[model samples]
Target: MGSPLVSRGFQEFGSALQERRLRLLLAGRSGTGKSATGNSILQRKHFLSRLAATAVTRACATGSCRWASGDVEVLDTPDLFSPEVAQADPGFEERGRCYLLSAPGPHAVLLVTQLGRFTAQDLRAWRGVKALFGAGIAARTIVVFTRREDLAGGSLQQYVRDTDNRALRELVAECGGRCCAFDNRAADGEREAQVRELMGLVEELVRDQGGAPYTNDVYRLAQTLGGLSREERLRRVAERLAAHRELWPLAGFPSWAWPPCWALCCCCAFSAGTCPRR
Candidate 1:
């Protein structure tokens, strides 16, 4: 047997050999488990997970972890296309500051949804992603459906093909038939397997795009924002994402209720261990 220190060193060296950093933006409706998806990808409970009537994410939450041979950063945000956000807070770009949080930009934006629960709101979310990122991003996007346990003996592709929902079918087609299923409640081994499968698709996508992520005029705009001082850029991103709370009247909360809410959200991001890694 080798010395314990040498063994640890070898393990880290092995990780380095397969170390590829991937930034992924997980987008979807409020209850669709965007944060849970990020946790699943990172293989840890880094983001808050709870049952809430409104958006629990509040703002963009970023988390990262080493998965197999790759390092993945997942940016989870409040629902951009939520009719509530679009109608109430017009300033909240459906994409919000997710791109900005992703900085250099993401390798892929995984559109998350609950299995068999694709609703009108989800369609709006997809439209929001297209509106902000452009249709070209559809090619780089992957539809990730959570709650695989609900599939009932069928694969995700089969469900997509056999489902009666035209909107869901169309959305899947738009993503170039790229889709994945994850059970956030699964055991560790199973969850990691799912992450590896999704990463495999990501690798293929990276190759097809010649190692570039999807980008558009909005991405270019975000790149410009990057030139600002780090603190100022982060401040700007927070302000942009803060717009999501302006119209939470449906929650019966007063407009003045937002400042405290924003503060609490910021606290959650850091306290929940989802803050951006340096």
Candidate 2:
């Protein structure tokens, strides 16, 4: 292995090769506020919101957002239990399987659900998610309970402590006891706190995986990529290269040339435009 710093650069380069941006797939039941949570994280209304009874999201919707540290490529998926999606795509389960196997592959997976009712259905949904995404993903997953203000008297900790929701407790334990509550309806100091906590958790998880410490530059790059569409990213890269070309006409070449000139008694002229081999 190379030095830690060099190894980290290689890992980041590998990640970039896979896709120029880190992809996080957000998943949950319909009306669980998964989309709302996404919008909250992105700090913009990117995903479509609806107050319907059934699954509003029929397919995957992707959005990008820039953070102080990095770019976030969030894929808001349809409810795992959406009948239309399941029926339409025979490969849906396979896709879910891939996600499960590759997860935490995402820097993080935000499992959003509403507050108040921790029903058996909800428990089953959580189980399904784990079953599909795989147990490893849970280690990087955070349970973000939306509409947190619904918990009348205390913090989310107190609520969790008081509830007899065994499945929820198990889910939390499985995810390394990482949980956060968010009120997507409003912005507050708590929301910022939650984001910071999530970022810290992500950093810790990546480090535990023997990865390099997350840096501001990496995060900035991610943020820049996150805010762009596929076409836009390519376009920007092209533009940047064009600008660089203007700034440095022979950037990669050195001031020398050889061979033919060596045979022609023009060695001094060759030295003006080519590099000396090491």
Candidate 3:
């Protein structure tokens, strides 16, 4: 309505209004470009994604940056579904760290994987997410395909529809028809477009859910406890947390707020909601 600078500033401000702060949890098996996807979303190389003999992400890594539209927090996790990570060691500490990093919750859970790279491990990974977060998470999830340049001339929607991989296709369908492709190697101009498109998808998801993030029973219970007296609530939370004896004395957790903190951590790990860092 005013000068060019003023108009441009207003546009950016409106975009931010359409989408404010978002917490994105990246999940997939190793080598699925989870970190790379996070880097692309941040428009920088914050998370490492180089090829390695073993898994590169041993812990849950977090990266946050302000985009033209709004702020985004990316939580990149290791292969939580792998037999080694799931059964043998389970990395409760790593999972707990990721949950704690997310804080209150996460908005959308991005199940990242390379285009045409869905395998048995990926399927297991999906199951693992369901196990931890509950069946309702599928609705709040988005299947993100990385390495889009290798898709030839085909579109991501077409690939999702035409792919012969039943499991992968079903996975996409389960997420309320939400999916996107990211060309992390694209030029600067193209990369920006891709990120913006992805943001649009995220905004649509948030809108569809009535602008509320996803949460499970554990998280809801923790929230309910917040209304109680501090001493009583902490006592109840501590009693409930006892069920997860293996996760007791959460690594790096404050000793004073162990009960509620653990409850929040568990809720964070298993919910698809935005964890407000601020």
User: What is candidate 3's lDDT per residue for 14-79, written digit by digit as tens?
Assistant: 364534667899987788888988988877799988978878987788888765445678989887
Name the lDDT of candidate 3.
0.67
Clashes within 3 Å, all models in order: 0, 11, 7
lDDT per residue for candidate 2 within 1-278, as digits (tens), equals 11111234334543534233445567666778888777766667889886887778766677776543345567787755332333444444333332332233566677777776544445545654554444456766778888777765468876666565555677777878777787777655666555555555555555565543222222233346646675554444334333333322221222253222222221122342462311
lDDT of 1 by residue, 143-243 (tens): 99988888776878887897766668888898889999999989987886787678767766766776665666545656778568766665565454554
Predictions in order: lDDT:
0.68, 0.55, 0.67
- Clashing pairs for model 3 are 105-273, 105-274, 105-275, 106-273, 106-274, 107-273, 107-274
Global local distance difference test of model 2: 0.55
TM-score for all predictions?
0.73, 0.61, 0.73
Q: What lDDT score goes with residue 185 in model 3?
A: 83
Misplaced by over 4 Å in model 2 are 1-22, 81-88, 93-104, 188-190, 212-278
